[model samples]
Target: MGKKLWYHSSCLLLFCILCTNSFAQVKPADFKYVDHILGYWRMPTKHSTFTELWVKKDDHTWEGKTHRITGRDSVEMDNMQLVRSGNELVFTIAAVADPKSGKPVPFKVTVLQSNGFVAENPACDYPQKIVYKWKKEDELDVHFKGVKEKTFSEIILEYKRK
Candidate 1:
């Protein structure tokens, strides 16, 4: 009777171990937003209104090219990596320094959409924080608080598929 009990207990233990192992082997797939986020998105910043072109490069990352098209193609920025962060997406904007000699400084970013169109991150100032909302017609609205008055801006750009 003792031997039978030991054999059954060992079998149950083995079964439990196998089940746990298989569950651990399962991995989650990366989130994909190329269809929803690709193309051009225009939003105003404190300095200028700019347009951003987002292109999907792979399953785990995307590329962004931003430019001040209102000027003579003057200002431009590019970033190649962006990863999903919890229920949102996070990316970094490289600081203006040579990567070979200087350490990389990132302008931390978080992306989300709400109430028409919105994107925000914790790095934004408290209260008014970083926010983007689409305005009436074609323009997109942006707000960032300052010491006194709340700075408001607008972005006028048309988004189209490549």
Candidate 2:
């Protein structure tokens, strides 16, 4: 019974791994609008505010940096990037401050619709899916969804163009 259970558990784990990596795909051309994601976005409050900047680097990539300010202090948040990779575009997160030195974990952009695009990194713990949606009418809507402690977790951040 013990051996049978162990074998079943191993198979289940392998299946999970395969499924996670086999998401959908999108064309590189569909990602062209990501350039509009550049410029600064901010959410303001009375005491503090959060701001993010996406700076373009050539035609294929944009460097991202975020700031959270409370009173007199401003804190730097995650540094990220969006880049074109072959037939698709990818989003990568920096593991440290010095981007050149840090190894980036890449999330493949799989779905690009009229509204926006979706990217996923199967191996990541906090954000398995990262989605960015924009319409000419207004703000950028971003969603981060993943699993946590055997449960699904999601966070949404809306940013207005500045």
Estimate, for each residue in 50-142, the C-alpha lDDT of model 2 and write its tens digit: 888999987778899888899899999778898886777888866422345557768888887767778888777667888888856358878
Q: Model 2 segments beyond 4 Å from truth? A: 1-23, 45-47, 95-102
lDDT of 1 by residue, 21-42 (tens): 5543312231432235555677
Clashing pairs in 2: none
Give the TM-score (vs. native) of candidate 2: 0.74
Where is the poorest 10-residue window by lDDT in model 2? 93-102
Error of 1 at 2 (Å): 54
Q: Residue 17, candidate 1: how far off, in angstroms?
A: 33
**Count of residue pairs whose backbone atoms collide, per candidate:** 0, 0
Best by TM-score: 2
